[model samples]
Target chain A: MKRRTRKAFISLIIAIAAFAILAIELYPIAITVINGFRRDIVILSGQPFKLSQLTLRSYQMVLKNIGFQLGMKNSIIIGLLSTGISVLIGAMASYGIARFRFSWRNGLAYSFLVFRMLPQISLVIALYLMFSYVGIRDTIGGITLAHTSFNVPYVIWLLLPFFTAVDKAYEEAAMVDGCNRYGVFFRIFLPIVAPGLVVAAVFAFLNSWNEFLYALILTGVNAKTAPIAINGLLGGETLTWGQACAAGTLMLVPVFFFTLGMQKFLIRGITAGGVKG
Target chain B: MSSRKPDTDGVSVSLIKGKARHRAPFLFLLPALLVVFAVLIFPIVFSFFVSGFNWPLSEGAGTRKFVGLGNYLALSVDPEFWNSLKLQLGFIFIAIPIELLFGFAAALLLNREFFGARLVRSLLLLPVFFLPILSGMTWRFMLQPRYGPLNALLLKLGAPEITWLGRPVTAYAAIIVQDIWRMWPFMFMLLYAGLTSIPQELNEAAEIDGAGFWLKLRSITIPMLTPTIMTAVLLRIIDALRVFSEVYVMTEGGPGSSTTLFSLYTHRQAFGYQKVGMASAMAIFLLCISIAFALTLVRKNMSLDSLEEKAGGG
Candidate 1:
């Protein structure tokens, strides 16, 4: 009877703990999602927990908003381009670092991390001036470049382990079978490292898509990202919570799927990849 | 013995040639490096050079003055600079412990077998992954005194509503709560991973020796999990020192400069006030603080580094 009582008490603590943590996380999400669909902001915020009244007016408003659509497109375009370029570059770099003993390898890798640790805003002001001078202002490519610089190091450092995990004997066997280097890589190596590459690509994509700072300073209309556009929904004059929540709801869909794909690789976290600088 | 070693010089040279031929893979790394250099490296070097000038970030470079060490010298006397430093520490002290406590507790709760374990685990990470501005902006709405849900919930529970972000103390408090929501999951995840790796033998032995759950947790789990816990804490402290996106989107360090973390302060100084020289010095100072903590923490937590060394074969 005492053992059973102890089990019940432990069960009760677990339930309460789980419920509390989940409530802390989910309360904001629940309110936003429910209220995002409502016709009136005043009604939702006033009675945020109520499930009786529901509407779809906010989504309709957000969809029709020009700035919202442009911001969404810019985020998607930047995310795709940056992820593609970064994963390719990172794959090659990590493969090189993993498979070979190049002379400048350690030095270059360390510098990449140093770049990662530096503040993002530290470079934003300088990039703004240069981008304007080079006639790249408000362009998706310029913002994409900034985002890529920050994310590629994360990808390379992350994807290196996957490359090294493939046995070197596979390459050696291909060499004996008269397959050239390119042929061996394609026929053997790429297939082996496929999951890691996908995970890396998704992670890079998510980081770029959710990026706010460089996108904030560098772009006005042409390249304004979702986060910036969401911020602008408030305007400086007043806080438009309803419209802002609607916009935030739209921005979150891609990120949700993006993370679902990338969470496995992040299980070890990034710092475990190789030598610490 | 000579016959057993039957490799000709030609075959060995060709083998050397095969190893040399893999330069094609390294060539694939160029496009990335070029983009990084153009955007990031060039800008950093340009910022340093611009720091040497009295030239404005805007139009023509007129009345340019050479000012070496003048920018850094001013950091010594800058009150806003010092307040920003103090405020950054204030954030670290306030955010780190709360997040650690909540994070570890949540990890322990979720680690045990439960009815909704998988669902709970995923839901727990949701706040951590929310876009920074969206999370801050949501809290803004939630803190609205009359219409906000938080206020409504407080009143429903028979408590008076406080103006959350309208004041300095409450504003920092709300920001810290938002930060803990977003950050604790990271620490919890790390600690959970650390928890799973603990050998069951240790816990079993403790139980057999008449140690209760509390005693086992205190003696075995906490002690063994130190390296992971410390690493998570250090990472969080460094991250909080650079806190910007949430603070910028939330309060923008106001109710009169209450939330001006070092990063946001440097940005405001450099761009808002256009003190490029002073901002660079400020950046260097914050950078020193981050690196100093990082070095000290790593020196103390050599076990985590040793684990990485073993894994990476360094």
Candidate 2:
């Protein structure tokens, strides 16, 4: 009976610990979501929780702001362009490294990993000077190239295991059946790794969308991203707490859905790529 | 020599059958190498060269004068550069262990079969997807002096309201807290994956011998999880060494220079002062640290075969 009681007490402690961990993890997000719906006056007045003070005014203001709208448009354009280029190039490179034996194979793979580990600041300084000389600074093309530089290496590493795990039988059989090398890669190998391709594409888009330093340095007026736009609200004398929260929530809307739908793939991708840098 | 002959013979036969000496791999790897070379490699090489000059951004390209190691020499004596590097190192030492501890505890707790395990797992990932900029702003809003929710809770509890980001120590503390909040989940996810990958039979064998939780953890769980733990720590340390956005968003390295991290100081030099050459020198320094960490990780973690598997090796 004494032993049984001790076990129960330990189980109770574990339960409480789990509850506290969850609470700490979720509280700031919960608060942000809730405050997004409240009036600015209510939020600033410390009455953010009062039920009657809820309003949609903050959302309206954020949606109607011209600079925020342009920022979102630019973010979408850059995100798609960069993700497309990164995924295509990354898939090819991952396939090459995974399937073939070459003298430079190991050297190439490790260098890409090194590039992925590099701090964006280190690259951004030179990119800033280089882009200005080339006349691509502050353009969508300039920022897209900047995003692709990091994203390609990331996508390659994320997809490496997927390609490596493909069975050799598939490739051999395809070749025997009169499929050319290109046809085998396009038809057989590509289909087998489609799920990983999707995962890599989504993550590449998210990375580009959430990128800040490159956008901050490379673009001035035309290509400011959503993160930069929201950060702009926090500057100067007056703090627009409500609008900032609302804009933040708006930015998170798609990511929230992506998290729920792609939870399995996201877990796999993060483990593979997150450990590198 | 006799055994190696057979292995090489088998590899040569398979290689002959596999591609018939076609240039497929080279063609496949061409585009990516081109892009990576032009975009990343070239800039890095250029940055190294530029660091040897006195190039100011405002003066246009023609005004650059060669100063061969002058900027690096200046950086050697620059107090701010050392201070920023020291602050970043201090941050890595303090923050990473706390994140590892929190993540390890949470992973251990949630490793079993339970009702809300799936839900808890997915929810843990929510914060990881949050934009760092948004994470920074949300914390800034929460820790606002008078009207912030944290202070409101403190007032109700009858504790004195503290200005969280107004002073040097608290400003630095706020940066740490926000970092832990945003990053602890990453550690949790990595450690949790490591926990699940631990062979169940080992634990069962330990239990059968009448070992307790702590003993099993010390002997079985920890030894098996060491590689994951090392990877997580090294990755987090290198990342923290160049942290920019959170500090930029939260404190902007300030009340004073209390929180001027490496990347932020480098950024201030390049943009705020237009000293592109000096900033390039700093960039080169950060690159060296990152490469050192990465090399250690790769050398420690990956075997030679894992790095490159030949047909014979396979």
The TM-scores, chain A only, for the candidates as listed are: 0.90, 0.92
Residue B311 displacement (Å), model 1: 8.3
Candidate 1 local lDDT, residue B221: 92
**Residue lDDT tens for model 1, B1-314:** 01122112322344424664555546656765886688767887777776665645555423556788787777778888788788878778978888888788877778877677777876677777788887788888788787788888888888998889999889978888889778888888788878888999999988899999799889999999897787788777766777788888888887787877788888888678777666766766665666576555544543222333443453
Best by lDDT: 2
TM-score of each: 0.89, 0.93
lDDT of each: 0.73, 0.82
Residue pair clashes in candidate 2:
none
DockQ score for model 1 = 0.42
Over the stretch A1-277, how does candidate 1's per-residue lDDT look in tens digits?
9999999888878877788768867887767666676656454456766665566677777778899899988998999998898888877777665655445655565555455556676677677778888988799888888888878877877776667567666787777888866677678778889988888887778778778888988899888988888888876676556567788888788767665655665554334332222
Interface DockQ per candidate:
0.42, 0.47
**lDDT, model 1, position A52:** 59
lDDT, candidate 2, A131-212, per-residue tens:
9999999999999999999888888888886776666778888887888777888899999999989989988888888788
Q: Per-residue error at B281 for model 2, in Å? A: 0.2
